[model samples]
Target: MSPPKSAQRLENKWDASRAKNMSEPEKLLYRSNLLGSDKRITNYGGGNTSAKVLQKDPLTGETVEVLWVKGSGGDVGSIAMDGFSTLYMDKLNALRGLYRGVEYEDEMVAYLPHCTFNLNPRAASIDTPLHAYVPARHVDHMHPDAIIAIAAARDSKALTQQIFGDTIGWLPWKKPGYELGLWLSDFCARNPDARGVVLESHGLFTWADDARDCYDLTLDIIQTAMDWFAEQTAGKDAFGGARHQSLPADQRRAAASRLMPAIRGMVSGQQHMVGHFTDSDAVLEFVNANEMERLAALGTSCPDHFLRTKIRPLVVDFDPAKPDIDATLAGLADAISDYREDYMAYYERCKHDDSPALRDPNAVVYLVPGVGMITFAKDKATARISGEFYVNAINVMRGADAVSEYRGLPEQEAFDIEYWLLEEAKLQRMPAPKSMAGRVALVTGGAGGIGSATAERYLREGACVMLADIDETALAETAENLSARYSADVVRTVTMNVTDEAAVVSACSNIAAEFGGVDILVSNAGIASSAPVEETTLDLWNRNMAILSTGYFLVSREAFKLFRVQDMGGAIVFVASKNGLAASPNASAYCTAKASEIHLARCLALEGAPMGVRVNVVNPDAVLKGSKIWQGEWLDQRAGTYGTDKDGLEAMYRDRSLLKRSVLPDDIAEAAYFLASDLSAKSTGNIINVDAGNVQAFTR
Candidate 1:
């Protein structure tokens, strides 16, 4: 049967025209991509799809059934042909005897590799057997919110029968492994007419002989549940309706910005964590509801949800009426400590003798009333995905609580999945994190050569970057290019006139909102002036000081405020100039402003030392390539002073240096990176000269 046409909540996206010419495996990939593209169908990396095709065996020249399923740790939306694990169907079936019993089923995962066909390198997922044992040619396993809502409800088996009668069956909760695969096989054998079955507190599994039919069945099942919920939950208050009105959009963001840094600071004890904040309509509605806390305490039901968001989220205590951020800030330490204690207690209460040691006890998702959701992880992409998973849980809770009583996986069941030995082994297999994985940097003049170079250096080591610059067009272009190289989740941009206090303040807030807080501050915004003391106008001199001196102070002060909030030792790298120490002809104002920057770093070092903030300088001289200052009149003026033209000035400067080398933007960037990284942890209040060994600028 199809979803009822009159009440269908999902539109069938299949085009026979698109699928007519596709081979069996190609159709499997096409179907999987279509299902995964919409989050309503499944979350990122949440589901699997497979097709059984008759193919010639490599060793024997006879046709054999082969199971092609999605590989472990792969996302179906972007899965390539290589992402599928191919295995002999007969060999997979033989594994039914290898399974000793339900208690020894996990050991079956170790035997999956022996069934590999064609020496395929991709590892099969634990759900591989579930797909293999199904009698149909194509199978779809998805965690759609609508179906999961019904599956996670109280007496979900009764709910399933009422909704789809005998067509769709229901099974009690079974930990996914070889044993669960046998259950599905047995269910299909007994009820040959059933199209699918919902695994309680898990997800849906649907199959059909035809690829297009399987795709249609999966969507139809989800839409049927969706349509039924719409009818049943119509005009019903979701999550007991709104207990607190949502604050205005701007105020919500303001509150998020105010609280994010302090929370980031308190949680970053080992490796730092980057944060993601979302104030979507779903998040706002859920956060303002009266039953929000009660429902959240029950935790998420789906295994994939707990894999990303943990057992539950920590609900931040904040009243919409009061809007007292300071009060919330004062209580964060205790709030966070209490959450940690409770998480440890959970581990103690439910852990098995051989369970993997308790993981980070901190909650990945944080819910704030009148604001939105905040999530933190080792990096920006993970943090963002964690937030997305919790939103999925929020949708499931809203639907289940509306029609039937919402039920979460029991605490012991959740802990079993959470601390499963297989899950822990998968995590252990991950590559070591990049040096700057969880760090955040705010780069001033980020569109300029030195600024962009420094930002890239940090990004390569896995830091989140906020590119702040006065040039809006250039900032956008640079951010776009950097984001393309790294995923967009790690790079953000803000426009600001660094000399303006208000603009600097806003830039700081935007950066904090974008990525928890600042770990590195690269103060590089400046303009070069080429004039004798007599020719230099007061406007020109003041302009130089305004950007090069006061501008640095404004941005630095804001960064310090975040550092203080985080209570984390951070790095401040000032891109001053060789002229700050060595004399330069016809550049008094430029040299004076540069000198002011150098002194400022030293002063900051004295005050920041107690808090573990290291202040240092990278003094670069005659960086001709990609320097905005050198692109303007500064180049011609410096050339004229040296009795050479613009083309000859770079050569003249290179020859004038002790090592006779022309310093480039990358050279300065390297020095800036060293100062900002832990490599220079003990060298605060120091300066590194990237001037091809200019003797006069040497710090020693």
Candidate 2:
């Protein structure tokens, strides 16, 4: 359909000058990216695009028509040239001769590798046949929200006809594979001049001989749907009008922070799960609607929507007006159990003889009336993306429900797609998760050397790290560097003074909101001073005690609070010093604070044991290379006391150790990681010294 002139029209982004110099494949990539740039057009990793272009055959030196389609599991928004799979058109067509029927469509996937063009390593997705069999030179299969609102409407076929006047066709929902590709081919052959077709309860498909025309048609078709809906539902109250008022933004997040941890504990039994919360305007509109619960129970129609969000969302029994958080927490177990039981029942009702073993059965999405949505997955990105997908579903429901009744896929069909054998194979083919895959850590004094090293190590192991430090500049720098190496998703930064009790509690809540809950706490924040018994002032003593001993106590206490809320076992690593055990001249205040830190760790270890929260210590001596404590008065004072200059003090500490080695920040970080990791899971109330065999600091 040619979209009408309306204010809701999509921006036409075609740049003639830029495209004038591009190859055919590059133009295809450009079109795909432009279409995918807007979530309203298509969602992340939800759709596929393809082009048929003539290329010189690498093996035969002959001109050939190659099918370049988006590879399996690649997102069009971020895809590059290498993301497309190239296959010979003739080989793809020949597979039509091999198609036994719709019953045997999955068998055709194994033959795709045989048809590779130029030996491209990118595997062709199942949608390859959908693109290959179509007669057009370019094809775009998108799940635009505006068009899907029409596609998922109760009378989808009639709506497609009314909007496009037979210019764009319609096909009932069929699982994508060999048969559906053939269905599209038959439709195009019959409706010769049609611009595209709407797949009922699915998405939109547009095609043209030219890539630019295809892009234009795609934008126009989706815009027409948007404009048409805009006119049809001009004055209507969406979702039968909002049934409840939205909570204030602060209150909304406060509720999510309270709920995510408890829910994570219940759902993370098989594998730990990370969480994401959204209170966006659209999410608020949907969750606060009168029809929200009914529409949610119907589930999502689009395969990609339900695949990411699960069959249906669980409507959390929370009332914003009552503000009963304790009641919500108390009932969460029963709510989640009911959801799991319902999912398992669906599985039993829909299982085929060879269906894959029942999967996690937990709902990926949770909807809280007057609050918003919460989603959980094995990692942060997935959890975030799942929330985004649900928002897309929300948009679809609003549009469809306004003009026509919203319709979800039948339970049997949703089950088939969710449990498709091919999908199970894809799931099995994914690489094993990293060891610290689903854990989150908070590193105090994270701007310093040992702290940054520990954060990086945890990030490398697939854990999310929230860096908390008193120094804002250093904290930002450390977070930026680590984020550059290990994506921004897994690393966050907060300016925190560990000795501040309120700051400690707030940081704990922020981490809960950012990555769901906390599992590891590395209390590495510290300060050092040097003075004889007579010269040690009360202020100096108090400063050292406050930062080293009391700071550790504050962060650990807050972490234990989160631990109780989550019911997940926790690991706490306190970075102390060798001075805690060995008496050194002219450092009474420093040694006393370090000794207090060690004894505090022992007491916490005894208290945390019954709750499965482990507490341990890493003590280091003279970690001078990148140690922030070594940069000030302590270095000069220690040098003067030992008859050495500033440059020679590090060497003195090295020589003082029995093994004669200098301990760097990374070395201390390694010991902290070991104690915080499962390597020392069986041991607590213990100290691992990274001080190169200091005899006097040895444990008894």
Candidate 3:
């Protein structure tokens, strides 16, 4: 069947004036962005692009041809001109003559430096030579799902010929290296009419004299394959509908919360690990299918996915019909133990004498029939990426099965790629990770000024954050904004009232299950109350004590228990106030409650010291901006007390501080972050004043 006219959705958005003004490499960056912006073509950092350009040699001042390939680990969607590694085209091609097929992976690394055009070097991608040998002015490479679905099928060769005719050539599976590059060059030269080549169990490549042509050729081939796929699977329902479960969403969340901690304890070995849960409609539908175990055991649709999804996902058996949380957790714990044992055996079976040190022997992604999909990795971003890839893999596998039987790369082939030197080098070349990379943090009152600021700070440092607040609407909005910047799995929200002990326990349990366990606890939930001691109403005083005092105790108690169970050192930062340390007229209720909470942390620090827990305090004053605590009567009261309008209160407080700097929410958040991180590892029971400078509030 021919591709439909409407199947091609890509339109050339390149502005001629835009290209005319930019340099050759910048134009290539613009083109690469166009290609990567669509996830159907490539995801995250899975693809590469390059162009051949003329540049002057520094020594001879003569124009020379150079191949500018996308550097290793550079994401095409956000790459800059500097992201391209410049190599001497003539010198790089000379390696084709000296290639021996053996030890190609190792030799490729040793030879990369010599082939580059300059002394200041960047690591070129493993596919660099494949682009250099294409004999075109520009080239684009992508791992389009539609293309990989067809190529990874058992009858890939026959499918290629039938769908694309002679316009596309097919290459058999060979590990990417100098040998593969030479083979591609020879095959394309022999078939002059071939506009692209389909690499079996790999990806697709296209080349043309113009950058836009090469990019469009990629989209054209992908559309053709997708059109054929649509026809092949027209009415077949290979994946069935979901099964009705005994538990509802709320119950399932509760059960998952109870089970995740035990499972993480069983599998994390010595290092702390983070976990994420994803139950999107696509995932639940796939997991609930009758043949889910059989379908999932099949290898990934592409080898590149192995780096993220691993060779296969572990299927966890969960019968929602019998929803006993304790029994379910015990069962999951046993299964995780078995999975870890099997992973180690597999690693030992496939390892070579010179193989790199073995990573943690645990599955990165797990398939739970009732609870959706869960991904476990060293950090939040990697875990989220792993889940994303597995979600894509499920769709590709279904597509391949719909057309022909899904066949993936052999197990041995996957092992080779996982341990390849070039792949390892790519990981090593990544920039230093953030401080809280693998940690999980929880913030009380996360919808307010200080809580929101603290949550954002922890997220910026790469920690998985859970925002708990009584204001469900505000919490949802804050979560949406943060999710846009990072990912949904990285920033989550729970509608929790801190004063409710049962609700606090349940919310903390869910957080433990969702992210293994919490490492940092920021107890920042409190309400403001100011009245003369004699005139203070019982309701006003009790409200302050409920949220400010009892709330702190309940949340900290839950966190302390989890920390003790994990036997890992943890940090707790209490957002007290300078008002607690300094006496002010008509502020008895708030001052008393905060002072008690501050002392409670000191007691916890002493008790937790023997167990390696550190507890500290950040006392802030006059952070009026974005503070929900100062709304309604509290704002007017403070304004009247300061003899100014509401807007003037902030400036008046700033003037009173010795340093003349107004205390801000972020200022308090920075102090909290330092206490939560290793920067304050040696200090505990210490209060960091973020009031700019308050001599009266100083503690000796």
Superposed by TM-score, candidate 3 places the C-alpha of residue 162 at a distance from the truth, in angstroms, of 2.2
All candidates in order of lDDT, best leading: 1, 2, 3
- Expressed as tens digits, the lDDT of each residue in 18-113 for candidate 1 is 889998999999999989888888999998999999999989989999999999999988898999999999999898877789899889999999
Question: lDDT tens digits, residues 1-700, model 3?
Answer: 1122135565556677877878878878988988888777877787789999999977678898989999877889888877889998888877866676666445865677787876546678788878988888888888877888878888989999999999888999887777778878998789987887898888888888887778778888887887777777665655543453435677666656665665565556756688877877667767777656777777686766878878888887777666565665557766777877877777788888877777776888887777778888888667777888887787677667667778867777887888876777767767876888878999998998999999999999988899999999989998998899878868988999999999999889878767978888999987997788998998888888888889999999999987776667799999999988997778899999999989999999998898789999999988987789989999888788668998898899999999999888899889989999989999999999899898989986
- The candidate with the higher lDDT, 2 or 3, is 2
* lDDT of each candidate versus the true structure: 0.91, 0.90, 0.82
In candidate 2, which residue pairs get closer than 3 Å at backbone N, Cα or C atoms, i.e. clash? none
- Candidate 3: where is the Cα deviation over 4 Å? 1-27, 55-59, 117-121, 239-256, 265-270, 447-449, 468-497, 500-517, 557-569, 578-583, 599-614, 620-667, 679-700
Which parts of model 2 are misplaced by more than 4 Å?
A: 1-9
Q: Return the lDDT, model 2, position 260.
A: 91
Model 2 poorest ten-residue lDDT run: 1-10
Clashing pairs for predicted structure model 3, backbone only: none
Residue range with the least summed lDDT across 10 consecutive positions in model 3: 1-10
Instruction: Give candidate 3's error at residue 299 in angstroms.
Output: 2.9
Task: List the candidates ranked by TM-score, beginning with the highest.
Answer: 1, 2, 3
